[model samples]
Target: MHEFTPPSGTLLGVGLGPGDPALITLKAADAVARTRVLAVPVKARGAESFARRIVAGRITPAHTVLELVFPMRSDPEVLRPHWQRAAQAILTHLDRGEDVAFLCEGDPFTFGTFIYVFREVARLRPHAPVEVIPGVSAYHAAACRTLTPLAAGDDRLCVLPATYGVEVVETMLERFDTVVLLKVKPVMDALLDMLARTGLTGHAVFVNKVGTDEEAVVTDVASLRGRKLDYLSLMLVRNPARVKEPVLRGCRPKVGA
Candidate 1:
């Protein structure tokens, strides 16, 4: 006699795209529709998740919603437990042979909370079926909204977390033709100063909550000096003049008459 085996449920990391419901891909929509359980993450209890809000209209009564509260902390020690707890919660549905879709804002692999939860889930349930659906990243959305081409021809691009400090950003600005600084809130002021000193103020653009109603774009980096911005804000810098410098390349600059 053949042995009977139960099918394990699939865990989907569904990326909703940058804050727009319109940006959700067809495959992501299908995943959302087919999944029996929807796992959403919020910063705190009672707080709304932008990820869930993106697909609010699509969620039917047939779907079971699970809210996973992840503490808003940068420390790994503090975040690990929350991730594990959320993973355990999602596993219950998977154990029942029901698919669970964890809603994520922006691309699931691009600094999405789904990455953490997915990691923990994988660790606990090694054989659990999991699939990731890619969505439009925040930086891509910001670039499109600003009508800025990330790179063209031989132009090199680099993306770094601005939380690494102004010194690191200063180095990257001199190295790449296009530099994207994510998580700009904590270091906005210092970054602004560095931009001014490097004469890249005019070449830089700041975007916050791209594709959302709270979206703000600042072409003038100087204006951001005293202003408070959202944590989701990022700065895109295209330093043609800096790129012309010989330090980045092995050539000397020709002075124009």
Candidate 2:
């Protein structure tokens, strides 16, 4: 006779939104409320987990919280092991038919730590059930708070980490009508100088921790130079004078048409 085996539980990647608990989607909240095991990403052992903090009110004693360390480093070699270990930790719970919800600050697929763990989970358990619940991204929240339109008419938009260097940013500014620079802490001064050089200092606005009590919006972006910025900070710039591409007939219709 063949032996029966219990099926593994589902792995959920829940986005809690950008630092604001209210921004969490209904689906994401339901996932967190129902799941017994919660995997949260932390910068170090015993360090605060921003994702966990966003949902602090929802966490009860019945929930089993697991903190997974994901240091603020870009080196893949150093990050791979952590991802593997976090995956294994979550897998341990899944094997027991217990759902594990990995909480993230923003949309799970948008520069969120959940992506790394999701990758490892897929590799380790190829057939495991997985679901990603999307939430409001930081840039979207920043744009909404500042009342800035990310794109209008035929305008183009670009979003990337400011660590790509000022040269790349400058090129992007010339090409795209709107550009959102994430994690500008490392290159704040350089970016300020470049914006001034291009006469775009007035066109940029700095926002950090949008949608939260600690949220900040700076209209004078140049003043941010020499000041330390949080890793959660970002800049939204609009180049209204950017040359628009001519629309070829039959290619695409005009915005109002």
Highest lDDT, which number? Answer: 2
RMSD of 1: 5.9
Error of 2 at 145 (Å): 0.3
For residues 64-87, write the lDDT of model 1, one tens digit per residue: 999999987888899988999999
Candidate 1, residue 236: Cα displacement in angstroms equals 0.8
Runs in model 2 deviating more than 4 A are 1-5, 248-257
What TM-score does prediction 2 earn?
0.94
- The best candidate by TM-score is 2
Q: Runs in model 1 with CA error above 4 Å?
A: 1-5, 242-257
List the RMSD of every prediction in angstroms: 5.9, 2.6
Kindly report which residue pairs in candidate 2 clash with one another: none
TM-score of 1: 0.90
Model 1: lDDT to the true structure: 0.88
Cα lDDT tens digits for candidate 2, 1-257: 98776798999999899988889999999999999999999999999998999999999999999999999998889999999999999999999999999999989999887898999999888888999999899999999999999998678999999998999999999999999999899999999999999999999999988988889999988889899888889999999888878855786677997
